[model samples]
Target chain A: MATILKVEGLWKNFGGLTAVSDYFLELPEGEIYGLIGPNGAGKTTVFNLISGVLKPSKGRILFQGIDITWFRPDQIAALGLTRTFQNLRLFPSLTVEMNLRIAYHTHARSGFLAALLSTPSFFREEKEIGQKVDRILELFEMSDFREEIASSLPYGWQRKLDIARALVCEPQVLLLDEPSAGMNTKEAEDLAVLIRRIHEEFRLTMMVVEHRMPFVMGLASRIQVLDYGSVIAFGTPEEIRNNQKVIEAYLGVGDLIA
Target chain B: MKQGIRAEWYFLLGGLLLFGGAFLATQFLNRYLLYILVLMGIYSIATVSLNLTNGYAGLFSLGHAAFMAIGAYTSTLLTFPLALREAYELPMLPAFLGGPNFVWPFFPAICMGGVLASVAALLIGAPVLRLRGHYLSVASLGFVVIVTTLAKTMKGLTRGPMGISAIPSYTNIYWTYLWLLITVYVIWRIVNSRFGRAMMALREDETAAQVLGVYPMKYKLMSFVVGAFFAGVAGGLYAHFTKAIRPFEFSFFLTFQIVVMLILGGMGTTAGPIVGAVSLLTLRYALKPLEEHLKIYGLIEIIYAVLLIVVMLFKPEGLVGQKRGVKKITVGGKSSA
Candidate 1:
């Protein structure tokens, strides 16, 4: 399979501390890639670098062979790569539907003048986008609370909305930072199943950062283990489970019970 | 669809009746009432325009008066008589600018004022908008101080401390009333569009806004320019109505008053600023005559402070703010409740 993302020798320095160093990644098209690490192992920083929130100090990032080392975050998103925060980041005061619509900003084809004047094309596109969002909301079982303020939604629903928001822009690559962070074990299992379904339904690549070993192991086709700003091991779930450095980094024998 | 049409018709009819009443007042009412009405109209422009940045985009700028001053001076330098221009030593400008007046008409002068103010905002917004929260406010306040000092020192164009007196009383009910309507309409249209939602996203969380593909700097600069443009126009109207221009008139106090109007009316909504501006100005006007006999300084401003405190204590969101909250959330839904 062709690679959708290629990161070569990526490094980030925050003054004295080196957060991430010499990180390399190659994610194949339509495959799920998992990045696992202990606390403060720089998984989120790597996501930030790829999303263009932080410029890599020394590295090259290629999305489909186009260098995006210094592109702005919005520009990177417009180029069809988007992400969700580890902590939920929804437009708090906006309604759930409006939150989804704003995520669809890049897809809004109506020009500014047209929208201001409420022209025919603007309304037509708006109605079509509305229909599309309605379908997604129903798919995610968020149809019952579309009018609720995003801030007021139940925690699990907010997490679902964050994932839904990441997909509305039709991104080719989706980076999910700790999607199962606050989920109960049952919810995490459901999320693992939902992610499997999503991987089957959508023709896109995914990179997920998760600390929950079982969730990551079951969902990802390939896994990379990071310890203290470096990739310690990379392999299939069974291989990574037995890797010596990965076990030692996680502070115990590899407990693969789940 | 039917509901939208009904609302539009009601808005048109209400506008016509209000305009009719204003026309009658100009022809037959007392000067004091007309003066108060005109003042409210000008402030409506200032507060409503300021809402674009300070409220919707969450910029919290404290230099709105600086933009107003730019508009006032730009319009004044253009239309002040040739004799007045010759009196000031305006060597900094081109020879033609210092020699004869541009002598443009009323509307053109006001437009030029808005244009020049927007230009200044464009130059300043790029650097200043990077700072967030109180840092942004202080930076903007510094801008106001700079503009004020320049006006006091520029002796040539501004006539130094002696400001340009004898400016024509060209701004009447027509000019102010029309500008107020235009300001409200333009802001209303933009705030209801996709661009407005993008702005609110930036206010919610800028990092998330970027991940969602809303560029912060582009929309921030746009709102800043729009707000400054209207502030400049309002300043021009005030200069003509008062028949004088002074550096002290466009001071920190003026910016404070407009900012108060925005917060008291509920910062994010179109109706909040209009409601806030008119009621506050009316209260101040009613108290103006009591100052000399009461012998207390800034009694009117004290009353405003109390009202703001009361709003913060009880209905902290202002009277119209929750309505704005409802505006974005419940669009196109059949359930009204």
Candidate 2:
């Protein structure tokens, strides 16, 4: 598979503090990659950098071999790289269907003139988009609550809706920031299953930043460990479990589970 | 099929009721009452337009009055012949814009004014939409100040604060309400459209909106331009009805008043701005004599301020906000019932 996202020698700073330094990772297409670290390990910061919310102080980010180091968030999104926030940034006032429909805006064919004229073509396109929204909602088992306000949904459902929204963009790569951060174990397990199913179903490249060890281990085909804003370990889940650096970064080497 | 019928029936009934009420008011009310109703109709259009930006798009613009001023001046100049203007010793306007016997039809001139205001909004929105929240609000307020200053300083064009008078009285209760009907219908349709849904999404979460591929700058500019267009139309009608055009007419106070109307009725709701504008305009007209009698020239301002504070304290969502706990009843349920 081709590399969908490549980050090399990425550096970001805040005044005197370097938030992310010399970070590097490449996510190949059709695989689940995990970024695991403790608190303030720059996991979310890495996601923000990839999504173009923050510019890199130094180095390059290439999406499909195109340099997107200085692109705006929307520009990056239009290029089929999308992300969800760790804290659930779903549009609260909009319904679940609306939340997904809004994401399909770039795909929708109706321009301002089409809307102004309310032409037959505009209505046809609108009906098609509506059907697409319905299908996505049904896939997530959220069709029943399509008209309900997104903010009113339960926490677990909100997370699912967030992923559904990202899916509406028809992204090549989906960056999920702690998809199971606030979920119960059952919810977390369910989410892991959903993530794997979606990865396979859509043939998508996914990079998830998560602190939950079991969730990441269960879903990620490859795991990259971060410590102090740098990739400390890169290997399979089993290899990462036994690596001395990974053990030391999470727990002392002597305190490893095995 | 039944759902479509119900929706269409509701719309038709509501429209008919509004038209009947307007017709009755024109037939039975005194001239002063008719004039006040016309003002309310114009203000309803302006307030609804403002809600499209400040309420729906999450942009807090306070420069609506500036767009209104642009419309008022543009239409006034277009319709008022230079021969009459010169005979009255009015300050000379630009050579290209000025000339004896120049007179566009009233309706087309009003539309031209709206287009001119929309163009101004596009120019301003390109830079202004980059800022968010309070930053946007302040930038728009600055725009109003700039426009006011231009009107005050550009003596040759705008007559330097002396204001143009004897504007043709082409706006009547019927025309005002007809335009109001059109404004409300257009906005109602827009608010229910996919574009409106995207705007609401941006208001809910900017980051999420961008990730969803809903370009924030594009939606914000569209809302701003559309809002300014309606405001311009309102301003044109206002100028013709009042039979005068002045820069001070579209002041910060006017913008504040419209904001109050939106807040009072309910932000982000179809009926909110209309209810707010009509109620507040009625209250102002009712209290005018008392204000004059008490020699409290600023009483209106004090009352508005107090009302806004009270609303903020007790009902922050305003009067017509979507009820939080109420479940939306679908067509099936209604039909079964």
- Which segments of model 1 are wrong by more than 4 Å? A252-258, B1-14, B82-102, B323-337
* Tens digits of per-residue lDDT for model 2, B187-275: 66566566887788888888888776777888888899999999999999999999887778788988999999999999998889999
- Candidate DockQ values, in order, are 0.33, 0.29
lDDT, candidates in the order shown: 0.85, 0.84
In the range B181-270, model 1's lDDT, one tens digit per residue, is: 778877876676668778888988899989878899999998999999999999999888898988988889999999988889998886
lDDT of 1 at B151: 93
Q: What is the overall TM-score of model 1 with all chains considered together?
A: 0.92
Show the colliding residue pairs in model 1.
none
Candidate whose DockQ is highest = 1
Model 1 clash tally, residue pairs: 0
lDDT of 2 by residue, A63-142 (tens): 99999999888888889999988888988777788788788877776766666545667667777778888888888899
Q: What is the lDDT for B213 in model 1?
A: 85
Question: What value does DockQ give for candidate 2?
Answer: 0.29
